[model samples]
Target: MSVTPQASGAASERTGLRVTYDGVVYPAEEIARGAAYELFSADEATGFEWAPRPGTTWPWRRFVHVTEVTEVQGGNEPAEEPEAPLLVPLHRNRSWSSVHQLSQQPAAADDPTLAAVRGSATVRRGTRMVKVLTGRQLAGYVRGWLPHGFCYREHDIAHLRTPAGLAVLRGDGTSGREGTDIGYALRWRAADPGDFDAPVGETYRGLLALPPRDRLGPPVLGTGFVPSSAQLIPEFVTRDFADLPMPANASLLAYTAEGTEVVLYTYQAEQRGWLRMVGPQWRHLLAAVPGLSPDQEYVPTGDVPRSTQLVGSYAGGEYEAVADLPGGFRVLAMTRAARFPVDSVARRLRYARWRGVPCLVLREEAGWLRLRLCRPDPDAVVDTGAQCHERGVYETWAPAPEVTDDQVVDLSYLV
Candidate 1:
């Protein structure tokens, strides 16, 4: 959470928002070069929506007007002029408005620019080295739970310190990682509960018990668990689960050890229980992980598992490929499927029933095998194919594409 809390003169502005970014608000004219945003709102939450934060809209708060802009000398072009902070009261419901215009391309607020001298909101805490993530980053983390059919949520977190240790009871860390809302939360480990701060920890734990998919109420609370003796109660709780269409008042748990330098771990779940690698080489690993779909079949051929049937055929005197398959019966105009598996599925088809009519001669030229996305894995037992594909039947990780000429397939088109 690098968004610096810009104190609104003796008053609070955008009180409940989960701050997503912070930077100089770009002027409307320079919006393209100024900032980038996700078009998300609590009203219609779905995907990673991008846009600038909304502006003020209350009655008394609306009194403060946007001050005149004064351009500073810098950049090849002029620097963005700053608008003096105003104190305008807005309707609490619609109070959260973008600082920039919303109807058109927005002048993004400043969030990306960083300096050696200036520390981020994460850095300022000074207790634990924080891994500050953008709402976009947070959303991606939430999506990883899809394969296993789980969903992770965001909540306001405020770790209030206590005597036993930092016990959170009512902190916004369980706050929403929202599109329209923008706010911040902190994660720290004081020597003891009250060693450094009070109320913050108790507040954080309390949020874990919040009900799921409901974001309109106060944050929930959690029972104290010894960090050393326990694993996250449900492994899924600690993961960066994204498939969650339903949101829960999730926990912002700290390492139980006293000042053990709590580290944050991110989890991503796919259609299966698959996960992308986390930490070091994350850039390269994330890029490669999706490409390597683990096997998704139910049977075994030699050491290989039954998977998508990928076969290339000679059609019209030219060499092409067959589409890969995971199920039976397919329709392929041209076949040139590749060999790869996500969990245990394969990508090669040795043969398929050549479709035909009983005694119909000219009408039945006999069509060959076809490839597709969700077909079943091939194996001996019709009963076995069902069992294996459903529970990782294959052993071989399908090889890469190698369309050899002599390969045989049941279809006449196969060479």
Candidate 2:
């Protein structure tokens, strides 16, 4: 029932279909197309796909795919219904409510950092505040659907707002932190509908081309705010650290307040999304580690091995990475041993698989290694006897080396 007129200079002008499902109606072209694609795509349409919004549950799935779609105009008679089960109605497709709590004042009225500011867009709705997305954020949302087995999408343009404007808010938090943050997205006018791989927010002026739309009125916000427990994209808050090269076989771990963490695998490149700690285990680790503080950094000294080396027999010893012990202070488990044959510690560990069968080797700190168990026999016990002898004969162990300050990236920025 709520409506916000398209921005003045949108690249295209097209009438949107009015779709009624489960009693609620949507007038946005993108919503209509998404709804139609879900409910009325031809039986032979091979490429149609849908990205079920996050936190979708039972029963709703039955009705989302309808045998027949009814496009409402002028309040015409209801279309003939199939014998299918009733569809669950979504209310918040086309609504906007003023935000009440301002997190940070809107971008200084005229900051040149629209993309940066917009990248972290949050809008006010009544007394509640929500996140909004634009550009790549929107595109990523649409793409997330297909991979999750929603439906194969043909044209992403259908998701675009008329008049070719940016700052398309995925009403409420459909693709963001539900009930908390509103998602803002940008729809590119020149985007190839069939090609969803196009870069987002590439054309600066193009994204900011349309004048901002005024958002205030009734139908205030979409009604169907699905209860979501997952965020479409993981957000990272970068901080400045002394950029420096890591020591041999070392990794840096980053932790945040929401029980979220990512291991920094900088050896190959400045990569992310390595091993993580979450769920019950996260709760356990969170008991320590500075109490789950966001933007907290945990640099590994690689002095103590995450895994323990056990001498099963005289032949060799087995090294398996194990969980960390909870504590407030750090201790270095140091020992001396003979050096190994391999040039690099990673290669040495990689060559130590007892059965001569190859498995993934994840290097912890120095003197410790964890095998990425990939063999079918989950219960198969590993023989570290031969490897232990090899280690004593071919490898040398020394005290955990000191970490140099210059090896960190200076990502700190002033608020």
Candidate 3:
């Protein structure tokens, strides 16, 4: 199915707006005013193929609450809303455990209804994706860690503004602690929907099989949703568990017990750094983030190694680029005017082992591979002489030949 925004002036035609559900068309205006609560997907849907208006990020898909629709254009009653689907939660209550056990069965993936609901969760270019962080994880992103692993869409979890409300989504497994009143998250616009994948089907079966001790957070539910008893928020993982290139204007945020959302930092893609956005009143939040100074106004990420980078060809020469997605990709240049759109674009990242430690090859120079530990631990740092850039992030250089099992990874994209 093709997903593309309609050309200019198409949105102004009210007659052109329509929604199709179960093969029936309805006026979008009536749906918007009555049953529709949100847009779910633009792909394979009618009337939603229009682009988001300027300064808006809404995707084309519209989600209509069938039960809420009182009437239809042709006088037919709306279908009953399907029963809320069950998702596997970590806590074991009698009622939930029985259903949870059922989800673990191999045939669960073949359930058509569940599969369709899982497939409904989609990301578009400009959809804001958020990864709820612990204080430690927040510091890693500040230092240079790229977005990877599990994340959620901001649209799905916007109502979860308080620490208590958001605790269910945390990746650090510290949500069970008493008196926990603060939460952190990294939010960025998706450059492409292909960068994400639902944690369902045969490809993700291994994540579900991981032992408790081997994983960091709640066990993968394998039902394509977060492990929450009260919420059915769908979950997504970066494809192949690889890092996506950080886009411009990504924000590091904090949520308080009082439900206040504060912007902690905004990434400056052009400068390769994060500009502190929190004020002195909220500075105390930084205390829990190791090695980060609340007083520092800016932190440079260029020094820290990154796993993925946007490389573009401009004016017959290739240069490192930055993604300002939904806006476009451009050469990473210092002056604003000189930042020309590249003729071609591709992502470049390398993977290899240094001293038996899996590392990301950031760059190569003179037979040396600048490597960053994929999973940094004390022993890994010691083995590779990787210096601590910040908490949990380490980098060092190794001879090219010593970097065994080396492989270059490249993904091309349209300019």
Best by TM-score: 3
TM-score of 1: 0.16
lDDT of 3 by residue, 1-415 (tens): 1111232123323334444555655443322123332233434465343435342333453444433234444322434322232233333453544444444444566666556656666777777789988888888899898998779877667656557777888776566374367778899988777778887877666555544543456777777777766565778887765678899999998876544468899999888889998778889978888899999999988677566888999989999988886678998988999899889888887789988988877678899988766654446656888764322235799999887999887788766
Q: Taking the tens digit of each residue's C-alpha lDDT, what string does model 1 give over 1-415?
A: 1121112211123223111212222211111112211112323233212232334221111110112223311213324322112222335542323211211111211222211101111111112211122233333333331111111111111111111122212112332333212221122211111111111123233223323332222222122211112111100121111011111112112221111112122221112121222334222212222333223211111222222222333222322222221122122332225222222211222222211100101111123122111111232123111221111111111112211121322222111
Off by over 4 Å in 3: 1-107, 176-179, 352-405
Error of 3 at 341 (Å): 1.4
Worst 10 residues of 2 by lDDT: 234-243
lDDT (C-alpha, whole model) for all candidates: 0.20, 0.22, 0.68
Candidate No. with top lDDT: 3
RMSD of each: 23.0, 24.9, 11.9
Better of 2 and 3 by lDDT: 3
lDDT of 2 by residue, 1-415 (tens): 1121122001112343344555545332222223222222212222223322222211111112221345554332333221112222224651111111111222221333322322332211111111123223322322221111011111211222211111222332223232221123221111111211111222111212212231111111111111122111111100010011111222222222211122222121112111222333333322322223323232222232212121111124322111111111111123213212111111011222324322333343554444332221212122222111100011112122311111211111111
Q: Which stretches of candidate 1 lie over 4 Å from their true place?
A: 1-38, 41-281, 284-415
TM-score of each: 0.16, 0.20, 0.66
Looking at model 3, residue 153 earns an lDDT score of: 78
